[model samples]
Target: MTAKYLVTGASGKLGQSVLRHLTETYQVAPGDIIAGSRKPETLSEWVAKGIQTRVVDFDDAASMEKAFAEAGRVLIISTDALDRPGHRLIQHKAAIAAAEKAGVQHLLYTSMPEPANSPLLFAPDHEGTEAAIKASTIPAWTILRNNWYFENVFLSASSALASGHWYSAAAGGGIAHILRDDIGRAVAAALVAPTEGKTVYTLTGTKAYSHADIAALIGAAAGKKISVVEVPLEGLVQGMVGAGLPEPLARVFASVDTMIGVGGLAKVTADYKTLTGLEPQGFEAWVDSQAAAFNALVK
Candidate 1:
């Protein structure tokens, strides 16, 4: 079956949610969707549902070509190679090249919010990928600049719940954290709808919250006292390193906090609602929903 939509990185969390939305919510035929991943065998459940599965390694130009051969629209989920600098950009360029060679008409990319100016160390990869997508021959493209995911805060929140202390460098900055599932729904909606030319959407929660505010919400939900301590950027990085995090990932965490402190993730947009016709979950509500996780952390 010829796939009308192709989703790269199909084994990842975001990819799985997007595929679910396409099949369950948007009602796209399973056979009309192709799930692409480096390890196609891991997508057996999707294949069993009549969805086509193909190997699409960004590093392998030939694999990308085969994966995109029969796809009308392709979604290039950004690769998870943040630790290795410059490697992700190379992979993204290769994907774009293969997509062009396959004559794919429409391309969609999952990018971070304000990559061009984000303080995050991995911002260059997204920024470069967006530029490559624009420079590609694909006639139509949509760029979803997704905000920080609430799921990302789990590690910190869990640690705080266990230790009763939350450390950060985001002094007064606010982050409009959106759920990964919400991003998936919005991406699925965009792919199913009729789009023309180049379009950009900033996908974020309706509201933004500071680290202290988030900690309060977590504290309330977990029925524990959690104090957020604002530290210096260097101190945060050192703390992370002391906690056994690798230097590269520790640096990423510290840089992200610094970015947040400078208002990098503070933008709240209605693009998610505009695309999906639904309001996004707020930070407080999301924290409440994940109460079990927080509770478990303390237990």
Candidate 2:
């Protein structure tokens, strides 16, 4: 192999997981990999392992171009720029420009679920980025439209589980949630594989279920009674605001809940399974595996 792999945002949780998987599971040589981050110093461990870490900021074109100079493939890990409007899309566009300049052969981007169809508050940025990638001159690209993560459950589960109460905007819709690692693995698969003809995929869990089902799983695993409560979309946003999220972030969660309620997050597919040749984990299985982590975080 002529050493082809450039992972942007490698310091991020998902990026780190993908890097670990590539090294451990795939046995990819560290020297063949390149990681990009604003603070490459943070990746001292990976660097010690022989992976090259470079300071590449999406906002800084020169750094990005230098980072991808010799990279044959690029993974534009979506920026967590939700806190600022249009910031993520602009950053993505910049990365695409760099990838093009670097003569990168492929691009694997992380995208949200059905951004084109969902009005889930912060979907416009993803939609806009998708459009830009489509319009770009890049030879090949893969859009991994990942669904909601099972981790979101823990954020709302512990509090309500102890109180025997739960709340959500998704009234009856079922969510096909996957772990963050799964998303990372999917991204890696897209990045390294010869997926020239494949441009898009909806990655999700093996199964999908509504909140009531989620409560049931959590309750069964924890040996406690947990109730699932539905809230009006507007009330859901209000509840989020009361929880200390900024008005915009609160509304974003509310709309996500609304999307859940309307099956926005239920678009499960066999793409992940097909890509990785392994069945995706189920919602309950994820919760069970996180028992220790959840217990430590509880109380």
Candidate 3:
């Protein structure tokens, strides 16, 4: 059978979720999907279900070319190579070049929101990848600019709940954070029913929430008062470093808050609904669903 859809990074959380949506939710045949990953053996479960698995490494041109050879639509999930500085861009460019050479019909990329001007540390990689995709000879392409994930709150929220204070530099800025599963569903929908020509979709929650607003939600969910302590970007970075985080990761955390403070993630878009025909989950609802996790932090 010809592979109609190919998803790179198929073993990762977002990739697995997208694959599940394609097979279970959209009723796409497993035989029509190609699940590609660096370690093809890790995808044995998918392979068991008749989903063809291939070893596709963004850094290896031959692997990427072979992976895209039979795919009509290819999804290039961004890699987590931020620690290596320019390596992520190099890998993404190789993937795009391979897809173009394979003559794929449509190419879809998972990108961060506002990469061109965002203050996020990894924005450059996404920006460069998007540029490369646009410059390539691929006949069609779609860019999915995903907002902050709701699950990312646990990176800082758990520690904050333990201390009863959430220190943040994002004072009044609101972020329209969406769930990862919602993003996965939207991505699967895009691949299943692709649009004509070049398209860019900024997927975000229907509602935006400020730091104070998130703290309030946490307070309600955990049944305890969680204070929002506003701090300067430098102070936030220093505090994170003092709390045992490495300098580079701490800087990334602080930069995210600084971006939030400048309303970088405040855009509320309807792209999710437009693509999946479902409303994205609200922040309050997501918080309530994770009440057990939040309450555990206080205990």
Specify the poorest-scoring 10-residue window by lDDT in model 1: 280-289
Instruction: Point out the higher-scoring one by lDDT: 2 or 3.
Output: 3
| lDDT tens digits by residue: candidate 1, 128-157 | 999999988889999999998989889788
TM-score leaderboard ranking: 1, 3, 2
Write model 3 residue lDDT over 100-184, tens digit each, in one string. Answer: 9998989999998888877888788999999999998898999999998999988878877888899988878999999999999
RMSD (Å) per prediction: 1.0, 1.9, 1.2
In terms of TM-score, the best-performing candidate is 1
- Report lDDT (CA) for all predictions: 0.91, 0.83, 0.91
- C-alpha-based local distance difference test score of model 3: 0.91
TM for every model, in the order presented, reads: 0.98, 0.94, 0.97
**In candidate 2, what are the lDDT values of residues 110-179, reduced to their tens digit?**
8888898676877888898889888888888888898888888887786776677778778788889998
Q: How many clashing residue pairs are found in candidate 1?
A: 0
* lDDT of model 1, residue 171: 85
lDDT of model 1 at position 211: 83
TM-score: model 2 vs. ground truth: 0.94
Q: Would you list the clashing residue pairs of candidate 1? A: none
Worst 10 residues of 3 by lDDT: 190-199
Q: Please give the TM-score that candidate 1 achieves against the real structure.
A: 0.98
